[model samples]
Target chain A: MNIILVGLNHKTAPVEIREKFSFPEASIGTFLTQLVTSPLISEGLILSTCNRVEIYAITENAPECFDYLSRFIYENQKYHDNISFDQLTRHLYFYSSTDAVSHIFRVSSSLDSMVVGETQISGQIKEAFDYAMINKATGVILNKLFKKAISVAKRIRSQTKISENSVSVSYAAVGLAKKIFGDLTGKTVLLVGAGEMAELAARNLVNNGVKNVLVTNRNYQRAVELAREFNGISVKFDEIGVELAEADIVICSTGAPYYVINSDMVENAVGRRKNRPIFLVDISVPRNIDPKINTLGNVFLYDIDDLQAVVEANLKERQKEAEKAELIIAEEVETMDRWLKSLNVVPTIIAIREKVEAIRKSEVDKTISKWQRELSEEEVGAIENLSQNIINKILHFPLSALKAEAHLSGGSEVIETTRKLFDLAEEKQPSQDPEAPPAGTAESPEEPISRSRDSRENQ
Target chain B: MEILLYKLPLLFYFAGTVVYLLFFSIKKDSLSNIALGVTGIGFLFHTFILILRTVESGHLPLSNLSGALSFFSWGMILTYLVLEYWYRIHILGSFILPLAFLSLLSAAAFPNEIRSLQPDLNSSWFGIHTTLTVLGAVAFTIAFVAGMMYLIQEKLLKSKRFNRLYYKLPSLDLLDHLNQWSISVGFPLLTLGILAGALWAGDVWGAYWVWDPQRIFTSVTWLFYLGMIHGRLTVGWRGRKAAYLAIIGFMGVVFTFFIVNLLVEGPHRFI
Candidate 1:
């Protein structure tokens, strides 16, 4: 069988095209059920997220499976009249076997994400795999492939610093606060304005374990509204200096024309607070906090430009780490590719031998039953032995060739050609044997293709 | 056998220091653990050497400069291991192990031949004094390392330069806390050590007070740590000011340990 992937991502399609193809989370089970019912696909999984939608499937013919899956994706979304099949095909990309395995690994590791080192994509991929598993849409091949992809993603996360730094402005501010305060457990944060950025920073701080939040704005009603959202108390804007003396962290994003927090004001606050360190993040267009405040001892101040600079610098660091992640993904892909090739080779070899052996046994029985006179038991045994010897002699060279080809690179093509020469494809319809145990799971060299009902039921 | 024990630890300590430095640059988890394991082995060998020396001399191994230096290195490693276990500060080894390795290296320069203790100089006070003083020095060394870490982390935050080291180093708050813990603990041990030395002096020289350079320098080092402890407790001096005091107080310790022993003549120099 062949493993194939067909999908369109943010790079290949715009948000409009991507959203059109996204499967609703609740209906994913129905979608996967319908997907695996197709004659071309034996095993299947669908990863549907806002940025991309991808389908991974196993089939006997890669070309036919890719066509069937792409068309299926189009039919699922045919209600959208704005786009046609031509437009979708222009955006869709396809990969088979090793390339397909490598693509899934990259996608799972977030190396192919819109934000290169994002942490959400791996979790999303895991959810999709779990959903497919619960829906009974994934057999051994897709199951093994998806499990390996998840592990590779986890390995990359631990081995490299890809997800170490914050990429957003609010998160960068929180990161700086952590570096200064060590732990935010009992620290107090003062929100100095009603700007959206300040609210985001405040929310991030609360999530990080900051216990008390003080919200103050020139418009007292807005301050009360924001404070209630944080489960904190509201203070008048005039009392900011008093709050600053008590606050370990302050986020200022007011739309004032001049500096709201001056050097003299911070200097006074520093003395009142016993020279304890305080962090200030001013994320306003027109500067709200005095730049001169940073020069004072035990005061840390970051304006909008500084926070953005931190975010950009962190993004660059993640890009550097992404190169290392790619190396890890490449090594894992090679390992998975080798196992897939072995799985293909072993099953085909078994199927071809079983086909020829069945033919030999039936022919010998027919000749015996057609006899006009009764034969001795020794005569019957001699005829069976003669047929078995002929079958072994004729099968030795081809079976030996198949076993030898299993050891070479790109050996699956040779195995496929051998299967076709013996007409082995039509013998075992993949979905017809719904109770057949998955092949090559144990990876035992001796009993590679043997299956029992117990094994299938256990799976 | 004693010589073999002494020399084996030097190589192990050198290896440990190299690995720690490599871990500092690479920031790999496995490398740090390997470094810790190497350093722990070195500490074991060092403990054996000190025990053997004490057995041969029939007293604590603090009578000569070589023995004193070896004991100091052993104490530093012990303190480092304890702090590492408690704080999980893996990078602290990168700063602390080099000093330990250098102490052992310099100890090799002094004569290590064991001699019977002098009757006039020998007393139970000698052992107590030396042990307390060396333990105090170990604490100061840790304080010094923590101070340096605090300054670097502080500078990175103030300048907004989030480099690799910036991410690797712990927060200023943690480094400051380490500084406080070390200095506060070191001050009392140092005071007791000085008191024990005076008691030993009274029994040996018939005078509790001495004008010797070693005595004067030890008192000076003791005063430096006293100021550090007093400043932190009363005035709430912390962060940058506290880190500066820890660094400066440790310099006083180094002067008392090295300068008085080598250049200045004193009764305490028994090598």
Candidate 2:
């Protein structure tokens, strides 16, 4: 079987078109069920997020599978009259076999994310795979593929510094606060204005477990509105001093022409706070908080430019780490590619073993029935074991050669010639048993092939 | 065998220093962990060397220059290990382990031959005095390290460079807090140590107060640290200014421990 992926991501399609093709989480199971109903797709999974819509499948024929899946997508969506199927096809990207595996690996490892090192895609892919497995839409190929993808993502996450720092302004603010306070739990955040940036910082602080959020604006109504949205309390503008004294962190993003928080106010607040450190984030254009306050003991002031600098620096660091992550992905893809190619030889090996074993059993039965004297059960069992062992020993070298050749560039032709020479395709129906031993099963006659596969996986 | 044990720790410390320096330059976090492991093993060997010397010489092994240097390095490592454990800041090891290795390396440069204890150094009060003094000096060394980190972090934040080292170093608040705590804990122990040393001096030379250069320098170091603690407590002098004073006080400690003993030829020259 071949692995295939067809999708349109943020790079290929705008949000308008991507959203139109996204599969809802609740309907994914039904959608997958409908997808695998086609004989072309043996196993299937659908990954639909705000940024992309992708379908991954295992199929016997790549072109047939791609055609069916694309048609399925086209027919399922209510297209605009001005839009044509050709235009839609232009937006879709297709990868087959090894490229398909690499695409999925990169996507799952967050390398293909809109934000290069973002972590959300890995979880989304895992959820999609789980949904497919629950709906019985996946089998051995997809199971192994997804397992390897998730593990590759985990390895990249741990072995590299890809996700070490925040690359956004609000998150960088919270990160700096955490650096100062160690933990944000039970800490108080004071929002000096009801501007969007201040609210965003407050929201991020709340998400990081800051206990109390106090908002203050020149207009009380706006402060109350912002406070209610964050489940916080609103204070009058005159009470900024008291709030600043009580707050461990202060986010200022007002549109005032002058510094709203002067040195005297902050100095008084610092004295009242018993010299506990205060983190002041002034994310305003003209700078809302006085720069002189940074000179005060136990006070740290960062303006809008400073936070943006942190974000930029963190993004650069992440870019460097992304380089390492790409290297890891490349190595992992090579290993997975080897394993996938080796899978092509598995059916041939199983078919040849069955053919030989069948011949041995039939010959042994004929020999036993024609015996002159009645043989005991032990003697009959010994003969059966002897014939089985002889068949296994004779088949070992050819199976090893086929397994070793599977990883080479032209190895599939060799496998095809062997199958034709032995007439192995005639016995393919028996070899298609769902209850047949899996590729890595211990009891199979192709044990060495499976063992080498296992070793590759461990690496 | 004892000599080999002492030399073995020097090699371990050197290895740890190299690993920690690599961690600093390359930003590989696992190298810091390896550095910690190597340092921990080296600390074990250091402790064994001290114990063996103490038992073999029937003294606390704080008489000569090598012994004093080894004791001082041991105290620094012990304090650093506790702080590293409590703070869980592996990067600090990149700063501290090298200092520790250098101390031990310098000690190894001196003769480590065990000698019989001088009769004047046989009193238990002498051991207590020297141990407390070394512990106090170690605390100041910790403060020095934390202060240096604070200054570096402060400069990074002030200039808004935010380079690779800026990411690897600890926060300014944490470094300042450590500096303050080391001074607070080290001051009282140093006071007691000075008193004990004064008493030992009176017993040895019939003078409770000596105007020797080492004594004066140590007293000056103590007073500087006291000023730092007082400033932090009363006037809220912290951050950059406080960090500068801590660094200066550590310089005083080095002058008192090394210069006054080796160059000035004071009454405390046994160290």
Best by DockQ: 1
Error of 1 at B119 (Å): 2.5
TM-score of 1: 0.86
Model 2 residue A419 CA deviation (Å) reads: 3.7
Query: Can you tell me the DockQ of model 2?
Result: 0.46
| Residue pairs whose backbone atoms clash in candidate 2 | none
Regions more than 4 Å wrong, model 2 = A151-155, A228-233, A239-243, A267-275, A291-299, A327-346, A358-389, A396-423, A426-459, B1-8, B37-41, B202-211
Q: What does DockQ give for each predicted structure?
A: 0.64, 0.46
Model 1, position B99: C-alpha lDDT score: 94
Candidate 1's docking class is: medium
**Candidate 2 CAPRI level:** acceptable
Each prediction's RMSD over C-alphas, in Å, is 7.1, 6.3
Give the range of the ten consecutive residues with the poorest summed lDDT in model 1 chain A. Answer: A444-453
Give the alpha carbon lDDT tens digit for every residue of A103-199 in model 1.
Answer: 9999998988888778899899999999999999999889999999989999999998898888899889888988888899989999999898899
Q: Candidate 2 at A26: error in angstroms?
A: 4.2
Model 1 RMSD, rounded to 1 decimal? 7.1
Provide the clashing-pair count of each candidate structure.
0, 0
lDDT, candidate 2, residue A297? Answer: 70
